[model samples]
Target: MPHFKLNYFDIRGFGEPSRMIFHYAGQDFEDRRWAREQWPEIKPKLVGGKFTGKFTASDTGASPWLEVDGERIYQSVAIARYLGNLFCLAGKDGMENAQIDAMIDSYKDYLNDARAFFWVKSGMGQGNLEELKTKFDEASKRFFTFLQKRIEKVGSGFIASKISWGDFFLADGIKTTMNFDEEFEKKFPKMVEYKNFIFSQPKIKEYIEKRPESVF
Candidate 1:
């Protein structure tokens, strides 16, 4: 097995799914984190140094990268998919892989909607609470409804009859959105059940219970 090392800031952000992947596979890897204040010193060491202008102080390097041996690989989705393949959890074959990708992409779109509202509107301190909440609800259901329909066809516990990287993505999204609105479990029971199924995995359950809580 190749030595794995994941480097990112000390927060959960995008790097978390990779961590979940590692733990799910029961693979041991380095989870390296840097303090937020240390970025001024760390930015210079990234592949593209900040002074070159190609990378910025705020830039997160191929974050949640999967460092094999000593070579650093970037891109969060690629890393997750690679890890999924390595662990034999990506999918049974090509068609299932496409299904997993579609599910993940939809989750990403759903997440982006909430992210835009929070970062662009809430961060600016201008947005109507009622209107935004309504929008958020619609966005959540639109994606969750799709997931529920698929899971209904796929059967219980695992999507597509077995675990896949898409499960990790959905699990992560559920945790994120629930923080915003806990009522999601009540609103979307099937999606909540899907989240529960992933969390119920022995390795994942252990990691979630033991892992340190961090703010994204």
Candidate 2:
């Protein structure tokens, strides 16, 4: 097994999926986290002061990058997908794998659209809270509705026919959204159930219980 090191901000924002995959596969890794204050010192060494404000920032200049046997890999999804394939959380065949990738890509699109509302909610940006909330709720309903149908079509406990990276990605995304809304479960019962199914796994549950708390 190669030595694995994951570097990211202390927050779970883009790193938790890979961490969860590590635990699920029983792979030990160095979860190197940096506090916001410490990022300045480390940022120069990692990305050399490149801040694109894009989620798909260059791997060389992004948080949530990974190193395996000292070889670096960039981008959060790239890292998570790599771990997923490494740990056997990927589909068994080419077609299933393509479908899983398609699902993840769709979720990314939804997340990109939702980021504005999340920023305002976190107080990191300014916007009308009520208006954003209304818009987010509408958008979430659409996204979750599509997700629920996908799960039902698969007829498996996970988003795919078998356990795959899509399960972790989609579940974690919904879990994050639910953190801010007390009524989330009521509004999206099926999605909540799906999230619960993935999170209830023994290793995932243990990780979540022991992981450091973050407002995000």
Candidate 3:
């Protein structure tokens, strides 16, 4: 087995899903994190600065990188998928895998579009909360609606009537979206159940109950 090392900030941001996947797989990994204040120095050593392309980032050069055999693998989605294959979290067939991938892409697109307003712009950067709220609602509603139909067709599991890496994507996503509005779950009970189901895994529950808390 390949030894694993993951590098990211000391927050849930984009790293938690991979972490959750690791725990769900009952695999141990090196979880390296730095405080936000250390980003400036770290960035230059990794990407977008002095090091530039030496170490890759998610999609561009952000973080939450996975290391194997002294080689770095960038991007959280791929990391999760890799672990999924090792842990039996992958779909039974190619078609199911494609479906899961599509969901992952949809959520990532939402993040790219809303990052400015919801994260850096609105409350902090330059975007406004009002606009962020509107965008957040639109994305959340669309995802939840899509998920509802999917669950109805699949029966129980998040996709393909079984648990898969796709569950981790939405497990984190539903929680993150719910942060935008406390009552968000009230509108989609099935979605709430989905979130609850993912977190209910014994290993995942243990991790959540004992993992060090961070502000992200």
Candidate 4:
């Protein structure tokens, strides 16, 4: 197994899905959480590090990167998908993989809606809070409604017939959204049940119980 060191901010944001993947696979890794004040010092090293393999940092440099035996990898979904393939949580066929990718891309769109409201609530951005909230609520319903139908079509609680990386990604995303709005369970009962089922996995449940709390 590769030695993994996951670097991200103190929040769950883009990093939690990969963390959940590691724990689900019983893979030990370094979960390096950085404070906002420390990123300037930390990011320069990542961009110019003497890593073994290709380094894939963005132009501005970004968090939620992974160091695999000194080879730097970037992009949240890329890192999570790589880890998912390593852990056999990815799809078995190309079509299945495509389906999973499409689901993840759709989820990203929904997440952006949530972030619009979150930035306002956190006072990091300006907007009418109520207006953003209304937009997010509608977006949430659309995404979760599709998710519920997908779960039913697959005839499994997960996005696929068995556990897949999409399940981890979607479940973690919903968990984060729930922090912004706790009424999700009431608004989308079936989707909430799916989230509960995913989190109920022994490894995941344990990680959730011991994981640090974050506002986003």
Model 2, range 9-125, lDDT digits (tens) per residue?
999888888989999998999998877776655544434664443232334555878989978888888988899898998988898888888888888887776777888988888
Pull out the clashing pairs in model 4. none
Q: What is the TM-score of each candidate against the true structure?
A: 0.84, 0.89, 0.87, 0.89
Which residue pairs of candidate 2 clash?
none
Against the unseen true structure, what C-alpha lDDT does each candidate score?
A: 0.76, 0.82, 0.77, 0.83
Name the runs in model 4 displaced over 4 angstroms. Answer: 45-60
Which candidate's lDDT is highest? 4
Q: Who is ahead in lDDT, 1 or 4?
A: 4
What TM-score does candidate 4 get on C-alpha atoms?
0.89
Candidate 3: C-alpha lDDT: 0.77
Model 1 Cα lDDT, one tens digit per residue, 37-63: 765665645345424322233235335
Error of 4 at 16 (Å): 0.5
| Residue pairs with backbone overlap in model 3 | 120-125, 121-126, 121-127, 122-127
Pairs of residues at least 3 apart in sequence or in different chains that clash in candidate 1:
none
lDDT of 4 by residue, 101-122 (tens): 9899999999877788988887
